[model samples]
Target: MAAAVVLAGLALRFQVPGAYRSPQPWRPEHVMGLVYPAVGAVVLRRRPRLVVAWLVWAIGLLAALQVVLQPLSRWAVAEGATGAAYLRWAAFWIYLLEFLPLITLLPLLYPGGRPPSRRWRPLLWLVCALIAVNVVFAALLPMRYTVGPLRVDNPVGVALVGELAAWRRPMEWLTVAAALGCLASLAVRFRSGGPVERRQIGWLGYVLVAVLLLGCLDMVVATPFALWIVPISLAVAGVPVAIAVAILRYRLYDIDLIVNRTLVYGALAAFTGALYFGLIGAVNLAVSGYGALAGLAGALVVGLTFQPLRLRLQRAVDRLFKVERDPYRLADRLSRTVQQARDPAAALTSALASTRQALGVGGAAVEIGDRDGGVRVHGDGDTADLPQEIPLRWHGATVGRLLLPPGRHDARLAGLLARHLADVAHAVRLTADLQASRERILSTREEERRRLRRDLHDGLGPTLAALALSLDAARLRLSTDPASVSESLASLRERMIATIGDIRELVYGLRPPALDNLGLEGALRALADDLPEPRVDVVVEDADVAGELPAAAEVAAYRIVQEALSNARRHADARQITVRLRRETHGLTLVVADDGVGLPMTADGRVPRAGVGLGSMRERAAELGGSCTIGPRPGGGTEVVARLPLSSARGAPAT
Candidate 1:
């Protein structure tokens, strides 16, 4: 089905004049007469009811061709084989007039939606029937042309041309009125139509008006020797070509763009040609035929002055066509505004406002990721309906989209603005990423400093104090009596053990060796061994989380559990602590629960912030792109549950 439609559409565009040998006495120069109705038949087959009225009109036209023109051509040829026969047959010509109705009905059959109502069908049929019968009767009894005997010889020829010429004025007025009616009907339908329908119908109107103007020019201004006839040929081919694009490619203004470009280049070519001819002509007139040397010098001068000439020509063309200026300057201004912006809000505001201004749109907006992991629109105060959202990309990743509402009046400008706005979004996102990265680095530095301070005060300070006490005891014993050295050695041994314990604590505080040597489960077990009052019971289940965790992830989880236990010991005042490490289908999970004195609360009854340890634990979880929650256990103490997402970490290395 798709292939057939494609072929039919191609056949319409693929015109080859004199390709078919017609059974009729003579054929028109163009093969469009055979192709147009064949394509129309395809449309009718697809949408019978929608084009029933059009088909009625088309059948009436074919009927007129057979009934009226065929008989006249037969009679004309029967008279004699002379050039007069050509004029006689041409007088009853109805081929060109049939195209107006065909073009009007073409789009109707392949409309953007369902067909028009049956209410308009009968009236359309009535018009076609009247025109059909009128042409037939007019052909049967031709009227007189010139006043008396001036019409002498070819009476039938003069009569047909004269009568047709006489009716031209009224017919033109009728054509204009009918076209206006059709346009008004389409406009009314368009207001209530969808976006596709509106665009389609709008292009149809352009074609319709083009058709009307074409018919008028052919009937009114086209003298046999005048050059106005050129436009008549262009109108016939151009209008259908426009409609074909609208139907197949769904591009309506592409034809207009081509036409405009053609006009531009055509004007430039004509100017160059005129300059070449005029330069040569003037040189000949001045010197009674100048030498080739003079012509060569003039050509060289024109070549050297080409840039300036081109610029002047461009300005003239812009003035004549009223072309829109490029918005590169506006884009540059927007970039500067974004660079100088003080905050995310300000940058977004400037970007959207500049986009709206440059493109002449109702409004525009920018969206970025928020702290809660969802997109939030900025600059427009509220989210309006978006016509199109063109994503901004940097390094093949989409940062944000340039959002504008649908049916923006200036589509070409709107597309251009979309690309510019995307560039601005990319720049803004890059800035945001850099600022965020800097803050993270600074915060991490401050955290490392705090950890070092805590280790020095709690571990190294006590170990040094114990070592000094042992040395001082040994020195005192040696000074008093050499025989009591054994007692002094025993006292030094005890102090030395205490110092070693302090050093070990310091080493563990810096980095737990069990995490690297044994894995997450072993390190967690060793951590549980340290708690005194709580009597920690460690449960390691399923064992999938042991070696699978990245060193950093393992370290983070171990620190989180250690902090929870420490919090339970100090604040929750818990007696028994249970640490559970388990692996699920998605990721690793850790739960540390304790039976303790519960937690302190505010007047509103939510948990109060008593220490920075809990905050630190939550921050650690967040750095790993995971979540943390601390709440009172149902019966007594507190429960800290941490869930780390493994989407990126699914079988990934530690780094």
Candidate 2:
């Protein structure tokens, strides 16, 4: 049908008498008529059920049909064929009758291809009735119509042209009312539709607005050349194109961005141009003799003010379009809050609030861990049921998810939020770990203090008291009985030696005396030698045996080895043990393997619960920014491995 319309239009232009001989080379109406129908035809093929597309196609084809028939009708009448002239006239009037529905019903049924509501169905019928009435009046009326340069009598009139002509004014008023009603329905749809629908409506609205503005301009200016007609015709042509774009949803979201930037940049350019010209004129007036300097000063002023003007225009445009959410501003505000926040949880809460405000979304939340029972929410309120979840990641691991209110998913906004919140999430995780470490350190310290107190009270204090009494007795007996003094001296000497042994044992428990003299490697060698039951082998790599390690690292490594050996002897039922230490670029690595029964296992085949010894060893290494691992060796024995950094700056103080 679209091809036929184009062919017929071309045939009429070439063959019809004096019709194709217009002075103007290009006709806007001709182009619009051909283009709108072709566009509609393409769209209709894709969406066969779209009533609006059919109407649009019909409107365009009928317009071109009228243009073609008018000249043919004139040629027929000039050749003295009244019947042929009346037939063409009837066809023209029928095509003209279609205009009412095209304008009134098209907008009402657009996008959805249906009426706005059931109540509007009656109005649609009324519009059809009006078009039928107009067609009937045009057919039966005894009126004579002008076809181009000739006037021909209505050959098939029923002698009712006077009454029909009288009714024309009322029908025109009704047509106007119907068109306004259709526009109102469109406005209602635009108001109620979601973001996607709104954008589709916006495309249509933009063309209508341009046409309306051009109409107003035409009325006010009254140009001799009809300059407003060009833009008005172009806007009419653009209507179908815009509709096709909207319905197809091709780059629909970009329409808003395009409109926003166009308005901003266009306004900025206009304002700057005006300012430049006004400055140049003022400078010219002030320095009439110095035209060059005035021009230079005006250029300088424009160059200096360009950026400020652009920013102001951008803000104005954003406000106008209600696209005021600035991602950078939101990110900056959240960054500052996160930096100043005393706790990670607090920082996350602030970030969620900022995200909600920036995106104009509903309740936002930061949910840590699983979505089920393990979930930890920080937000305005509970967000377990929120549908949208963007993962909050630290390093490469997903530590939590950010839940947002129900709406269209915006990948750009989600990506931006994720990037900004990554640092905060990482900081929160670190803060929690630091707090846990502190608690463990404090608990370990308290336990050590309790052990020291018990040893001092039970062993050293009692022995010291006994020795003092013995010394006093010896001193008193020295003058009274020389024989008693010798016996007192021997008892006091034994008591004193026992108290020194108890004190030495307590000090050894705190930190090995061997470590102070033998260094880490020597200390481990002595420990292996001291073990009486298990055959122990100590291997210190050539690089590490002579290298000096940090004090904290040395202590942590020694304690770890001591704990691992104790665990092996008490739990593994081992007969032999091997300890190895190697030096790397960053730190020292230690490994202890026992040739005994592997780690204790529960009925489920999992490693048994870790005891205090294992926990203390891990904590000691962690305090020095190191790691400890105890697992079954590949060869059926328990292996303990630890890596401690050599630099003091790399470790945090355990106390």
Candidate 3:
């Protein structure tokens, strides 16, 4: 019924004679108003109980009815109809329906199609009361209101009109308050809402800005350009279009980018316009003409500077929303927060709280470990429901996950949080690793001691006792059996030489013989020279530095090189190998490269496994307060690089 009534009114608007019509008969209140009811119908089909769709339908139909009444009343008068006055009066009250619902009720139930919560019920009724008060006051005001192109007296005017006037100012303020309350409701939802909710609100926000700008522009250009409000009011259709787009969920949640650009360009336009007119006015004031030339110059200047100014403003506004652009600042701030925290547990908690505040997300939480084994910490906000989860990893293992609101920028937050968490936990892990390494070293020393004791007691002791017995026999039989004594003495001499070799083997087990015989550089050169299959070169830029290196560092560097060379020789099928040693400021860097089949990698280009040889190299370096990394070399081979720092070198005998 509303659609037919509105359709006839619009058709009659164009068909009515020019004499009875205003200059234009088209509806200026909402150009392309058919969209509103259509959108309302769409929303109603999806959500029958939603008040927003109902409000949209009411607003659209009534606006159309307002257009129809003017011509109907005028026609009724021409026809000498008995209720012509009544028709004109109806037009007066109906115009109230146009803006009241839109600014108040519709926005209150917008996007979500329901009140945010029961707490807002009072505000809803207050707005309703305000709307009712304005209507009653207007009806009883005892004045002619716009009915068609002329004023029409109220048909049901009451004597309380004077009394109502006394309260009108206060009521006006109350009505304005009600309208703002509805807008506040929308804003609150946006701040506390989830990703889907934000995207919905963004649509309304987009259309609101466009309509507002167009509305203001229409007023400015109305008289000067002779452009009717009808033309600019077409932006009103954007409301329904935005509604449909939002509710339907057609595209990505990229509203932030769009809205940011709009703000930048809008401000640019406003500034440029103000400058243009200011320049024109100044020129006209100075010289009694040539304002056109000043306007042209201003236009040219604005045009030339527009792009540069836009870029600057864009960056400025972008910073306001995207705080993740500066990683150093974020990292430094989190680093301080974690450092200030008293304990290991407190570090994660502090980081969570700080991140929540910084991101301005509705809610955030940090989960350490998996669901079954780990603990979860939540920050202050709407963390009741966090839809996005980003995992935090340390040393290629997932340590935990960060739970945040569903948003496009969540990925960036994930990466930042993961890195920060890893850094915070590293000290604890490193301490644990050091303690374990110390225990292993103690166990290895004890095992070495046991082996040495066994070698002497079981093997060397019996041989020496037998040699003593043989010597005694030789003494006793010197005169009686001199020939037999010579043979026995020769056997004793062989036994003594064998004992010396056994002692040397035990000493070598404690410290390599080559390390004692030759210097650290010489040991590395000997290892390379022994590898006959692959041609090897040992390089040390400063030979003196190698000799002067701390004993423990030298040992670590030599062992790392030895293990790397062995691995390359046995596993890496290579034609050439290079052992390069550099004396760094506080440490030694050893790099062993083999021109062989590069390191075997997994399908994803990662090292498949850590071999014992590789692990040994890393342990040796770590014992000397340094690091070792093995990876595929630049051109076509595997390289094992280790650093051995002199400051924390494990205690070893100096050469």
Candidate 4:
């Protein structure tokens, strides 16, 4: 059906005899005609009952149908078909359908095709508000760009351009806001979703983003003979194809290399074009009356410089996009360009050049397992022997030792440089504690899975079987014993309700029901309400703070607060407690304090001892690149303070 519609649009453009068929403004950008609907169909099949799936497919169908509207409208006007005026008007307002769903709902409700959490509803409403504004403003104006001779004026006595000059700026801003809202929705989803779902978003996102990434050069600098048109067309068409691939996960692979090469070549084309033009301009200024000679010389110069320029650009783009992606490139050059000191090899003779540059150090080196290797020295400085060895690490995994000259080193800066040295010792440390950690994580996960399986098999399975038997028995007695049938069905209903309770328990075990039902803020308040004697008060400093938290961070925060409240109620003998959540640019700060006898200090008389509950809280924070600190409050009582970095909470390491 989609193919036929698209083909009809194409055929009508060529064959339809319209009186004023100047040209079809519909370019290959509108080629979403066939692919869009087909992809939507696949998604609907995967999620048969999802309402958003139907919306997505319907949007696709509308867009596909829109392909032929222009040619169809022109043909209708020429043939004096009824409703031709309306069809012409549709060409103008049809943009509402195409833009609204994509901006408002689809980002928040793709892949699984369900509505996002309730917190996201407001952002969607904002997008919808913008859409409504656009519709009202646009619909009031005329759309008379008919391919045929017929003049279609605005029904409201307005011009074709939709000129409410006062509202125009506001409308443009509304579009910008709508676009921002869509992006925010996508960002939130990406941050909160599981790894597989994140991958799915990535598949669709980078493809859409590539159109912008690749076109940035052309947007800023013109390409030769308007060559930007070809790539832009292909990119637009690929949007729907990428949607299909993302939904189906067909031939899914890492998109980084693809993005890198495509962007490099795309930008190189623009640069080459600019260079050619510049050369021609120079020749034209230097000589007159020999336009052909100047043109030939310019082409020759561009041809000669193109390959070398592309080679340099390829490496530059690789440096820009891919760091430590390929093992062959020198790690120094892969990270940053060498300054005007001397040769890059001489200026940054080692892999730790970036770290050296960042720290303003005299020299740095990596020593692993006493293995003797060739060292790349930078200058005549013989300070290598003056350095001391510190435990080397990469992202918290110890590899070897970092060698730094004796100085008052910054703790944070030193830790970073130590981590960067790990690639050198990665081979030897592959089977270290990392393996043990992985095994422990896997074993615990498997044990939990087994428990869930056992519960389902032993409990829910039997009840369901019993319900089926009862239904069969009731069916058999329906004609012979009508009174008994009522009694049996009543009993069956009670058993089914019990089964639902059991299922709810299992679901609750998977995730906190309160978090799912009432969001983070409400869940915290519910925890506070659960505590009666303590008079717990929950205060969330920022209104939008909870909404922006990722799912894992949300769970961690709730669990930490719950534990703190429990400890204060049971252990501290506190009569008052406060849970405060504050947002920062980098992360969130959660403080749970209670007015009671202060926590027992360790032998150091400063830090509180970490028991099971404290350890669990600390571990959760650690996993998110955050910290949990338990100590005595400034005034009195105990304070359990935690910092959760938003970048790590979002599952991205802070760079």
Best by lDDT: 2
- lDDT by residue (118-215, candidate 2, tens digit) is 98898788878877777877777776776556666777777656655877888889878888888888898899898668878888877777777776
Residues 475-551 of candidate 1: C-alpha lDDT, one tens digit per residue? 78786886777776777688777777867776776678888787888778777886667799888777567646665
Evaluated against the true structure, the overall lDDT of model 3 is 0.72
For all predictions, the C-alpha RMSD in Å is 20.5, 15.2, 12.2, 29.6
TM-score ranking, high to low: 2, 3, 4, 1
| Alpha carbon lDDT of each predicted model | 0.58, 0.74, 0.72, 0.68
Q: By summed lDDT, which 10 consecutive residues of candidate 1 come out lowest?
A: 13-22
Distance (Å) between predicted and true CA of 205, model 2? 0.8
Question: What TM-score does structure 1 among the candidates reach?
Answer: 0.40
TM-score of 4: 0.43
Give stretches of model 1 more than 4 Å off.
Answer: 1-29, 41-76, 79-93, 96-137, 143-235, 249-253, 277-330, 333-655
**Model 2 — which ten-residue stretch has the worst lDDT?**
19-28
Alpha-carbon shift of residue 205 in model 4 (angstroms): 4.2
How does model 1 fare in lDDT? 0.58
Each candidate's number of clashing pairs is: 2, 0, 0, 1
Winner on TM-score between 2 and 4 is: 2
